[model samples]
Target: MTFSVPSPDAIPRPDPSGADAEFWSALRDGELRFERCAACGTLRHPPRPVCAHCGSRATEWVTSAGSGEVWSFTVIHAPTLPAFIDQVPYGAVVVRLDEGVFVVSNLLDCPVDELTVGDRVELVPTRVDDELTLPLFRRA
Candidate 1:
């Protein structure tokens, strides 16, 4: 399967704030960054200010291995936005990273029906624009 890079104007951009700003910036540099709690050694996604496990305010950004397994997924047959109309039947996967955090991203370069729950996947950073690049996944 071949995926076309979307035009910057055709795709939605992230509006990063606080920790999110740092996360987005790292992606632009071709790195996948996630939050790790200093107090409890827990990893979390969506870049929270506090750790959910230990309620620790001490957190730091860590570069991920960018490899994971597909825990769950669905093929989007309907366009949720007009910009995605040309991208229907894409696999939206919930990948569980080896570090134990999960991220929701698109699974590319494979047929949707061929994806499985335990399928190994690796990050493929795709530039959405000059300032924003997304961490997409492909079969490992």
Candidate 2:
């Protein structure tokens, strides 16, 4: 499945840096990655500088298979943000990656009424422009 997104100019671009730098870089290069604590091998999302399970500052970037299930989701029938006004009725989802960490991103391609818990999805690295990219999902 596939869907159209707002123009790159209309959508806000990400400012990738710090712990987020690698993740965004990987996405731009067409890969999905997560932060894993080097000391304990614990995986985490929203890439952090320190491990939550262990107080380790050392971490590694692990590429994902980009396979997951829809853990939860919601449809924005009426967007409150002006930038997304024309994109009303989009899906916001929490995808539980096969590696165990959950990622919050938009669920694309599938219709709101058809979206359901446990729905299988896969990564679709979306490039917004020369400087940015997004890790969007689509039903597999």
Candidate 3:
């Protein structure tokens, strides 16, 4: 199949409710945030209800430095979704941010063959659509 970028309408929107509400909102405003425990100094991703490090319910959001290195990745050939059948050879990368948090994102500019573990990447807050913003990355 020929490759084509998915239309904005085809992309799913984040749920406006729940622990991820502020996380998604910050990205739309051109910022990246991670959950941190207010009761104890610990960071967590996926926006948990309580701190994994400590059983604290008090949490805060920490802004990222917008720079990181590729921790791991894989080039997907299997069709993940109907809207991405043609985009099979895309790279799915896990980036280790400067804050020591791992974030899953796709590369914005580099090809799969050129991408490698430990490659420095910089954040590019892209507005996928009027209501969706993504923290895409690129080779630095």
Candidate 4:
């Protein structure tokens, strides 16, 4: 029998200079982290060197509570990227955390029809390979 994985391209590429590098590193270590602006106390996503709100370089990292709600999503009927061909019809979601930052992640552990905006979900890591750990979500 052929061995199979749920999503072969689930792992993201590494960015050494991006603000998200620390977040990805933490996720690889089994922890979830968010960026918090020291000047405005605002939370933001896709990480940044300076706070978007106040342009402050001063920021801190906070571990996420690991729960969020689906803000938006799309069910891929076709693989837009060649790397994702094996995982077609999967759901990609924008999750709004309890702390207010939104993360782009994949929704897993259920049928595609079951996904909906505002659905509660939780973070779970999937092993794409021995070297890569990916953050995917499941119904909470």
Model 1's TM-score against the true structure: 0.92
lDDT of 2 at 21: 84
- The residue-by-residue lDDT of candidate 4 on 32-113, one tens digit each, is 8888998898888778788988999999998888899999988887746665666676778889988988888887766677
lDDT for model 3 comes to 0.83
Q: Per-residue lDDT for 119 in model 3?
A: 95
TM-score of each: 0.92, 0.91, 0.90, 0.83
Give the per-residue Cα lDDT of candidate 2 at 49: 77
What's the best-to-worst order under TM-score?
A: 1, 2, 3, 4
- Which digits, one per residue and each the tens of the lDDT, describe model 1 over residues 63-137? 999999999988777857776778676677899999898888887777877878999999998888788898999
> What Cα-based lDDT does every candidate model obtain?
0.85, 0.84, 0.83, 0.77
**Candidate 3 TM-score, C-alpha based:** 0.90
Per-residue accuracy of model 2 over 1-140 as CA lDDT, tens digit each: 22456687787767877878888888889999999999999999888879999999999999999999999988777736666777666778899999998988887768777889999999999888977888889889
Comparing 2 with 3 on TM-score, the higher-scoring candidate is 2
Specify the highest-lDDT model's number.
1
Residue 137 lDDT in candidate 2: 94
RMSD (CA, Å), candidate 3 to true, equals 2.3
